[model samples]
Target: MSIAGQAVGLFAVTNVDDLLVLALFFGRGSDRRATWAVVAGQYLGFALILAAAVAAAFGASFLPSGVLPYLGLLPLALGVRAAVQAWRHPVDDEQPAERGGPRVLEVAAVTFANGGDNIGVYVPVFATAGPAGTTGYVAVFLVLVAVWLAAGRHLATRPAIARTLSRWGHVLLPLVLLGLGLAILLEGGAFGW
Candidate 1:
């Protein structure tokens, strides 16, 4: 795929569910400052994710081709961890304060935690992309992140949408991660292990 295509594809796949999480955050009716902090934290966290992917992709050039696919295990492990957490906690245990509160670090932590699939998908894409392609992908991703935040904030005001997302979002996220991880492994031919 072209760099633009890759960026858009990656962003759409990795962030389709994030809109729900972002909407949940905005629905909290936190002060503007807190909302912006969450945005900043999200950007910071995503930057870190992209940086890691780029680094890994660059480094993978030195590793055997067969070994590169094993990198998918990182996301697989993360998905399992998230699934276990969701299973242990269940729906009722989630408090409103825990769900809606937006400390910068908390937002960053969640962004990073939820980004396992991003790393998995990005690493392979970046591995094939030259520096110019990587740059283009980064630019597109960064721009789309702002667009995503805006869309989430807009969605937050819709009571029906926000309520529905709040109710089921957490339950769905782990499953999405699991699917993404499996897809990554399959796409990378990591299952040969």
Candidate 2:
């Protein structure tokens, strides 16, 4: 796939749950300012996630390039972890007590909390890409953040759709993460598989 396509897929797969959360946030927001707070918070959280991923990627460069594929284990392990959590918790997307309160920091905190897997998946991918490719992915991902917000707000207006996604996302995310992990490992010829 093209770099932009890859970025979009990565963002969508990783952030699917976030979209639901964003919907909830918007759903709670009765004021225009509250809506903007959620948007700002999402951006702040996403920026930090990207920063951590980039930093990790830079650190990874010191390792032999051949070893990069081993880093795919990060996501593989996380996928297993998420699957276990989903199995145990079932409905993990509980509405936060704060209910997307107007605190920008609150939304950012939730965004960051949800992004642990994103950083894990992004690190090796970014490390593998050339500078131009990484930049392209980042650009694409940033743009998608807006798209996600708009989509989330739309979901907010439709409670039934939001609930369905909330119910199914936990089940699907694990599968997607597992697939992404295996694909990464295979692409890198990890363990000669």
Candidate 3:
């Protein structure tokens, strides 16, 4: 796939968690700044994790041959889990305000908290994508992050949307996670798992 396509796919898979976090963290502030801070922190955290994976690969391969697909499956599983949760326990009308400022540190913490699966998947992608593919890969990832931030900002501003999302957010998570995980698993296998 082209860089654009890859980024879109990755972003779509990863955006759910970011969206959820943003909803959870919705507070009175500049949505634009908060979005950038959160999204940038996430992408930066992902990049760092990829770097660490590269370093580890140089010494001992942490991911097995079949690991990439499994990593991809994470999102699918998470999505399903969220959906189930939502079905079982619906969201309440009252939504809590976000607790922190757009401090770089806070953003980084939120990013890290939400980036576990992203980092896991990145390990394989970084290990596999050679020098020729790195630029495109990075580009795609960044664009996706930017797009996600934009969407998140919009969502943050819309109280009705936020309320609705919160009411069904738990349910949505599981389905989205499951789909993303399955897509990654399949894509990895098709490409060369």
Candidate 4:
């Protein structure tokens, strides 16, 4: 695929769940500052994820290929943590003011936790891309992140959609994270056990 195509594809595929998470955050009626915090947090988290992918791509020469597959454990562990947290706190009843409507760290943590696919997809693209292509992919991804946030924010204002997401989003989120982690393990051939 062309660099642009690859970037778009990766952004679309990796961010499907983020849209829901963002909507859930926004549905809580967070103040503008808090909402922007979520955006900033997501950017920070995504930057970290991309940096790791780029590092892995560049450092592939130094590491044994088998060791790279084991990196899948990171997301698997994150998924398990999220699932446990959800199980313990089944209801999200905290007021927006009380918890500040998705703190930056919370959003960042969730973004990173749910980023197994982002890393998996980005590493291969970064590996194939020349410097110019890598730059193009990064640019595309950054722009799309803004587009995604806007879409999620807009979705949050829709009554039916927001209600549906608020109702079932938490339940689905853990499952999605678990699935993403399992997929990474299986796809990377890290499931030798």
Candidate 5:
């Protein structure tokens, strides 16, 4: 796949749950300032996740070549864990009540809290991507964040859509994560890559 295509897949797979969370926030957002703050918070939180992944990738570059393929296990384990969690606790339609107006920090905290899986998937991918590929992935991912926010906001009032997402997101996420893990493993040992 092309870099943009890969980025889109990675971002979408990882952020399916984020759509619901953002939709919830957007649903409650009456103030322009809070809305923009949520957008800014999303960017800030995602940027931090990307940065940490990049840093880990950089560090991983120094490791032995044989160790690279093993990195795939991280996402695989996460996928299994997520699948088990979803099986154990099925999603309900209960939505979060809007507290007061959410600030940048509050939204950022939420965004960051929700990003553990992103960091796990990104680090191994970035580690293999090298400099230019990493740049392309980051650029595409950042652009997609705005698109995701817009889509979420647009879907906010649609209860049917939200309900569908709540119903299926858990199942879809584990599948995506499992596929990503398999891809990484299959494409592993691309030494010159």
Candidate 6:
């Protein structure tokens, strides 16, 4: 995989950190459930994007050439932002809360927020993966779903662990995002400035 390809993968997979954040801040149960729910949505979203990429790869025309690179910047910025935020705040390491909001919307928003980096990274992946990209893309989605599911369970059961994960997210997520941003800017043809 190219650097951008790796960036996209990192973006999608790195939300383990975010899960940690949600777990720590919200204290599992509602938070944990909410995070996982969002992850489920993320899986669907990524799958759709991957499918589109596959279709494009197979010569089914859809978005323009100029569009993908700009899209790349979105994830680049998102990753960097998440990482920086994590580093700045770190995890509070608190007890879980009994209260949480509706599962679907919370999950969807977070999933969408988390997806910024993935989208940026995936543009290149789609182009590179070619027509058979679905297999690899599917593999990515499955791994993500499994990871979030496990993490969500862990957070729900063990609030402390959730806190620990958030602290790590705070420290590591930003660095990953920053690196991804630089990588995207350098490698993605979409960025001319």
Which one wins on TM-score?
A: 4
Residue 106 in model 1: shift from native, Å?
A: 0.8
If scored against the real structure, what TM-score would every candidate get? 0.64, 0.62, 0.54, 0.69, 0.62, 0.47
Query: Candidate 4: TM-score?
Result: 0.69
Candidate 3, residues 38-132, lDDT tens digits: the string is 66665665565455455544456564445545555445544564466556755455753332234454444445434545655555666677655
List pairs with backbone clashes in candidate 1.
Answer: none
Best by lDDT: 2
Poorest stretch of ten by lDDT in candidate 6: 95-104
The runs of at least 3 residues in candidate 1 whose Cα sits more than 4 Å from the true structure, single-residue gaps closed, are 60-100, 162-193
Model 5: runs farther than 4 Å from truth?
60-99, 158-193
- Model 2, position 191, has a per-residue lDDT of 93
RMSD of each: 5.7, 8.2, 7.5, 4.4, 8.8, 7.6
- How does candidate 5 score on lDDT? 0.69
lDDT (C-alpha, whole model) for all candidates? 0.69, 0.72, 0.55, 0.69, 0.69, 0.50
- What lDDT is reached at residue 68 by model 1? 48
Per-residue lDDT value at 22 in model 1: 70
Q: Is candidate 1 or 2 superior in TM-score?
A: 1
lDDT of 4: 0.69
| Model 2 stretches astray by more than 4 angstroms | 60-100, 159-193
Candidate 4 residue 62 Cα shift, in angstroms, is 11
Question: What TM-score does model 1 achieve against the real structure?
Answer: 0.64
1 versus 3: better TM-score goes to: 1
Error of 6 at 135 (Å): 2.8
Candidate 2 lDDT, tens digit per residue, 41-120? Answer: 89998997788788778784343446655655655665586579667765545652222234587567556645766787
**Alpha carbon deviation, residue 165, candidate 3 (Å):** 10
lDDT of 1 by residue, 108-183 (tens): 6556556756777788888888788889999999999999989988887677866655566555555655665566
Q: Which has the higher lDDT value, candidate number 1 or candidate number 6?
A: 1
Supply the TM-score for candidate 3.
0.54
